[model samples]
Target: MPVLISGSVAYDRIMDFPGKFVDHILPDKIHKLNVSFGLEKLSVNFGGTAGNIAYSLSLLGEQPYVVSQVGTDFSSYRKWMKRQGIHTDTIRVVKTDVCPTAHIITDLDDNQIAGFHFGAMKYSAIQATVVKHKVQKLVKTKGAIGLLAAGNLDDLLQLAKLYTLKKVRYIVDPGQQLVWLTAQHLRTALAGADTLIVNDYEMDLVLKKIATTLPKLTARIPRIIVTRGSKGAYWYYGKKRLTMPVAKPKRVLDPTGAGDAYRAGVIMGMLDNWDPALTGRVAALCATYAIEQYGTQRHAFSRQQFKQRFYQTFKQQVSL
Candidate 1:
């Protein structure tokens, strides 16, 4: 079975700042606040929730089908994907003139400020209108798994419904877009997903908004994975709470896309049918690597290297 990655594809423009962000802000300014810092350098990389996940999966030797839209400027990004052995045939082009883009700035302390322009990403809603046909065509040979990463709100809801209608196993990962969804809309998206992956902050918000217990929140969904920054991750399913320790990072450069990297590890684990404990450890290791690099796609390691890291961190051999 092929894993379908449905979400945004864009260029990530990263800027490096030499000074701490706190140096420019005044606490005694009362209500006035204005500041700007000169950037030391700028680097562009192929990234987006979908692209990041697909890239991570490729490192693990999984070829995920990315079904998303790109703008006219996607030439280089497309080239990179093909070269990386990711399945890009399903990628569509937006009718617009430019592709989606994310601008991020990281300070000396590794704090980040990011802004996203949904350029080509906006076309995802239109793509959702015909996604059933797309799904049908792709799954003709075997069942396909889906991970609905962050994108247009309506597309998220529609794709969730379509996946449920077809009974395709899927993971719902709203990411930062969770803020754009209403409680009712969130419930709709969660109704039939095989699993829901959210960070600790999002988990707290979802619980508050949905007004439900941990057990009740996951009643319809089989599993809910909550990631806590340095503490590690937790999985709630079938009246039990499971925990996985963190894979210590070599160095923390940027935490921008660690969550997506973790999700890629989770998908890989699912494909291999690994135990929950093993899956969580794999995800934690992926995240550890993600934070060690400035850009999401910059984290790369061979299977042998990853296996060695896994054993060193968890004191157990890779079973998958």
Candidate 2:
């Protein structure tokens, strides 16, 4: 069975600002502020929640099928995906549009700012037609085991509903897309999920929006893994709770797509039937590698190397 991933596929345009942003802007003149900072350099990288997760999963020896959309300019990115061994049969191409792009600028102090152009991603609502086709096909053929990552709120929710009706199990990850959803939609997404993954800030918002405690939410969802950057992660398995400590990397370079890497580990762990501690620890190690690279998909590894890192960090052999 293919592990299905439903999310966005975007290009990341990164820029470097040689100086601090605080030097040019005055807080006192906040109401009427207009300033420009010349960037020292610009680099483009492949990313997006689905792409990043699939990249990490491929490295983990599981090439998940990506249910996403790209644009007319996706030729290069399609080639890149092929080179990385990612299965793209389910990706829809909007031939008249350009792929969505994330514009990001980071100062010397590591402070960053970002702007997003939805482009093809804005038409994510149109993805339902394709998803319906794919889902029907999957049901007729192999069973569906999937990941509902960040994407169009309606699209994600509808797919979740469809999968539920079909008795297909999937993981729900709201990522930053949680802001685009409503309390009702949020609750719908959480119901019947095999696991729910979100960062701390997202988790707080979800909890507040739903008017429920973490324990209560976990009672329905089976598992909730809340990730904290440097502190690592927290896992709530039904009524039981577990803490996952940070796994040290050789070095830290960028924070982009670390969450996606962790989700990939979670998917692998769920498939392997590993315990929550082992799952989160393996996820932490995966995230450590993500932070060591400038681009989300640039990090590379093999099972041997991952097992070695796992043992080095936890002092336990990776029997899973």
Candidate 3:
């Protein structure tokens, strides 16, 4: 089955501040505070919800078709993705605007403060010819998995409905975009998804909002994964709930794209028809790999290496 990835494609400007942000700000000063801190380090990398997930999935030998909007400046990034074996035919490039850019400043504790300049990404609502063509191809292929990271709400909902009507399995990983969705809209989009993956905070927020409206929606979904950073994740499949431990890493580098990597691992597990417990463990292992890398897409591992790590950590052979 083909993997279709949909979300943002942007450049990440990562900056590291030397000290904790809380040290400089007074709690009582609140709105009257203005401060600037010197950045100890700065670097640029290829990132964004869809790009990260697609890159990780590609590492697992899945050629994911990324459907996202970029700008004229995306040529270099596009070339890199192609070299990585990710299908970029569905990625749209806006000729008149600059690519999306994320300015992220991380403090000593790894807490981040970010500002996003949407640029060409704001035009993501427009349907691209390339995306339509790719979707048509997937329809012909049948049984493709649609992975939605973040995108135009209307477009995502429409695509989800279309995929469900076409019998295509899909996984929804909304990330920060969940804050923008209404309860009813969330229900509609999730109803068609084969799996819903979100961080712990996001899951709590979603559950709180939907509990009053569609109380049974969560139970009706095939699977729901709540990722809890270093604490690991919780996987819900019908009446059973499995808690997976985080894989202990020898060193920590960057946690920026760990969640995306985990999402890819879960998708890989599902494609392999693994159960929820095994899927969560695999996802946790993927996150550990990401945590050991400086940049989101810089990590690479052979299937054998991954299996060895999995067995050493979880004490179980990965089922094919």
Best lDDT among the predictions, by candidate number: 1
Q: Is candidate 1 or candidate 3 better by lDDT?
A: 1
TM-score for all models, in order of appearance: 0.92, 0.91, 0.94
For candidate 3, write residues 112-142 as lDDT tens digits: 8888888887775337766776776785675
Clashes of each: 0, 0, 0
Native RMSD of candidate 3 (Å): 1.9
User: Candidate 1 vs candidate 3: which has greater TM-score?
Assistant: 3
- Give the local distance difference test score of model 1: 0.84
Q: Which residue pairs of candidate 2 clash?
A: none
- Tens-place lDDT per residue, model 2, 1-320, is 67888888989887878899888779999799998889988779998888999999888888687878788888888888877778887787887788878888888777778888777776664355765586568755455577888875666887787677777778899887888788889878866687888889999999999899987888888788888889888888788878899888788777877889999888888778777778888888889899898878889988898898899888977753
Residue 126 in model 1: shift from native, Å?
5.9
Alpha carbon lDDT of residue 248, candidate 2?
89
List the global CA lDDT of all models: 0.84, 0.82, 0.82
Model 1 lDDT-worst window of ten: 124-133
The Cα error of candidate 3 at residue 303, in Å, is: 1.7
Kindly report which residue stretches of model 2 are placed more than 4 angstroms away from their true locations once superposed: 18-29, 107-111, 125-131, 139-143
Q: Sorted on TM-score, highest at the top, how do the candidates line up?
A: 3, 1, 2
Model number with the top TM-score? 3
